[model samples]
Target: MRQPERERPTWTFLTHHARVLLEIARNPEVRLREVASGIGITERTVQIIVNDLRAAGYLDRERVGRRNRYSLNTELRFRYPTEADVPVRRLIDMFADRR
Candidate 1:
């Protein structure tokens, strides 16, 4: 018998979104495949998160060359249960400042 695929945890989704926000903030020109590789998620999942983030006012991305350049709306609050205290802007800034 074939084994069933394991379901992704809820935290995985949240982390994916957070990582997506950070990636866009830092480069604003990253490819979905890169994001997927960095976050250990599939490209399709990243796309879904991008759509959700955009709808939630967390990201505003545009096409640039073959990749997408993004503008994160850091002012937006997270809709996820975790990392609710930290605003998107603060999260991205925190990550950037570490460099």
Candidate 2:
């Protein structure tokens, strides 16, 4: 008898937003295209994510001549109240320290 095929899982613990933020945290000067490739998302999507982060005051962008430099607002708290006491810094540090 043939075995039944298993379906792939569509859900993930982390959202695209968090993945984008983590990518930025990993590389302060990373390119959006690179971020998109790393996250398996489109460059346009990465751009939108960056805009969202900027508007939320979670990050700041600085024009560094021909290239753009990004700075994170680590002191900012998570949006959800469940993690209200946690600062973005802690989250960044958790992943940043891995490498």
Candidate 3:
């Protein structure tokens, strides 16, 4: 007998970059390995995405001893016209855990 195929989503509302950013926002001290593991991506990819975000001025990194810390530039406006007026912080807050 033939088995039925399982359906899976091919897309999501947020991109991998957004997911990484949100993870960083939630824990500035989080490690790249943790982000990669949590998001199911490679550590190298996480590093690249982090570099992209830093280059775009969306994030700032500070070296502390052997570890690095991140700080989000929440005041920056969204890149798209549809949400350009909205601050990045608002978006982060939407997905951030309320405690």
In the order shown, the candidates' Cα RMSDs to the true structure are 6.1, 5.8, 5.4
If both were scored by lDDT, which would come out higher, candidate 1 or candidate 2? Answer: 2
* CA deviation > 4 Å runs, candidate 2: 1-9
Which candidate achieves the best lDDT against the true structure?
Answer: 3
Per-residue alpha-carbon lDDT of candidate 2 for residues 11-92, written as tens digits (9 for 90 to 100): 7787888888888888889899988987678999999999999999999999888877899999999999999888988878
Ranking by TM-score: 3, 2, 1
Alpha-carbon lDDT of model 1: 0.74
lDDT of 1 by residue, 76-97 (tens): 7766688577677776777855
lDDT of each: 0.74, 0.85, 0.88
Residue ranges of candidate 3 with Cα displaced over 4 Å:
1-8
**RMSD in Å for candidate 1, one decimal?**
6.1
- TM match of model 1 to true structure: 0.72
Q: Report lDDT (Cα) of residue 90, candidate 2.
A: 86
TM-score of each: 0.72, 0.85, 0.86
For candidate 3, list the clashing residue pairs, or say none: none
